[model samples]
Target: MDVKTKMRPQILLFGDSITEQSFRSGGWGAALADTYSRKADVIVRGYGGYNTRWALFLLHHIFAMDNRSAPVATTIFFGANDAALPGRNSERQNVPVEEYRDNLKKIVQHLQAISPTMIIALITPPPIDEKGRMEFARSLYGENTMKLPERTNEAAGVYAKQCIELAKDMGINSIDLWSKMQETDGWQKTFLSDGLHLTPEGNAVVHKEVVRVFSEAGLSAEDMPYDFPHHSIIDGKNPEKAFRVQCS
Candidate 1:
C-alpha cells in the first residue's frame, strides 16, 4: 500500500441502500468526508436492498479479521428491507424481527472481535409513509400495482425498537432515525423521498446525528490530528523541512 494511504486511519460506513447512496449530492457520507477531511478516511460499504441476514455472509470478506489496521469507527444501518410485509412482492427481503435482532448482535460481535477498541454505531431504519409508497409504486409499476404498501411505519418502528434495545444491551451507540424523524411535523414529506428512502433534508438529519454521537465518543474531527502538516507550515525555501517532520 502507498505510504499516504497506509498513514491515514479509516472510518467505515456499512449498511443497505441508504448507505450506498450516502455519497449523493447531499449525502450524509459526503458530509462526514468533508468534516473529517484530513483527519481520517471514510470508507463506504453499502449493498442496496440487503437485509441483516445476507449481511452476515459478507462480514468475513469485507472486514477480514487479519487486517492490521481496522477501522476506528463503523456505522451499521439496516432493517428497512427486512421490515417488508410478508405477503408483498418484496416479501423475499423480509426477515423476522427476532432474527433481525440476533443478526445485528452477530454483526456487532464480529466487528468487536476484529477491533475491540473500534466504535460501532447502529442506525435504526427510518419510518415509512404508506401513501408515499403507494404513489411511488404506481409511478413505477402503474396504477395496477399492489393495492397495499409493502412496508409500514409501524412495522419499521418494531424493528427500530429492537435495534435500539440491542444497542443498549451491547453497550454501543445507536441512532433512532425511525423515532427521530417522526418527532418532526410532516417528516413523511420532508425526510423521505420515497416512503422508504431518504431525501436530502433527511440526509442532513443523519449527518448531524452521526457527528453528534461521534463527538460524544471523542471522535470529533476538530480534535483529530491531520495526517500531514498544514500547507502554511511548509517553508517555500525548504519545503522538505515540513514533510520530513513526523505526521501530525
Candidate 2:
C-alpha cells in the first residue's frame, strides 16, 4: 500500500434500528469506528419502527440535503420492519416477496447514484427465537383463526437470499450473516433478554461476520472485537418488558 495511495473513503451505514444502534447508541457502528480509527467515518442513519419506505426516504434525505461533497462507501441492513405490516405485529409476509426485493434494489440504486464507488453490505436480520414472540405474533394477527404461519425465521432468510441474488445479478458486495448466525448455536446464547435484539456477544458475532465479508472483499478495514457497553432501554418503550442485554 503506497503511502500516497489514498485509503477508501469512510463507510456510510444505512438501515433501521439495527444500524441505528451501531451509530446513535453504538454497536457494530461503534466497533467499526473504533477499529478503523480515522480512516473511515461510518455515518449511521438509523430509525426505529421504520420500514423500507422510510429507509429509502431517509436515504433520499441524506442525498438531497446532506453532503455529496465527499464520496461515500456504505453497508446496509433492513427488512426486519418491512416483514411486518405497518403498525401491525403480524408478518406482512403477505406483501409480495418481489416487492421487498424491489424496495432494497431501489435503496441500492440510490446509494450507487450518490457514490458509484460505494461498497454496500446487505446483512440479513438476526434470528428471532423467543417462544413468547411466536405466540405474540400469532395473537397479533389472530393467525390461529387462519392458521397463518408461525413467526418466520424463514421470511427474513428468504428476503436476505433475495438480496444476495440481487447483489450477484448487479455485481456488488453483501454478507449473508443471517445464514451464518443460524449456525451459531443460535440466539439461545447470543441474544439480549428481549429475544429480538442482540447482546454484545451477538453483535460481536455480527461484527466478525461483517469483517469476514469486508476483508474477503479486500475492503480496507481492520478486524477487531465487537464489544460495546449495554445501552438502557429507557423512555418506557421497547415492548418486551424483559428486554435488556444479558450477553454471554
| 12-108: candidate 2 lDDT, tens digit per residue | 6777778777643437778877666645556667776566766666767776534544334567777666665333344543344587688888888
Worst 10 residues of 1 by lDDT: 1-10
Give candidate 1's error at residue 227 in angstroms: 0.8
Report, for all candidates in order, the number of backbone clashes: 0, 0
Best by lDDT: 1
Error of 1 at 96 (Å): 0.3
lDDT of 1 by residue, 92-141 (tens): 99999999999999999999999998989999999999999998999999
**Global lDDT of each candidate:** 0.94, 0.63
- Give the backbone clash total of model 2: 0
Instruction: Identify the runs in model 2 with alpha carbons over 4 angstroms from their true place.
Output: 1-8, 23-26, 85-95, 130-150, 222-248
Q: Would you give me the overall lDDT of model 2? A: 0.63
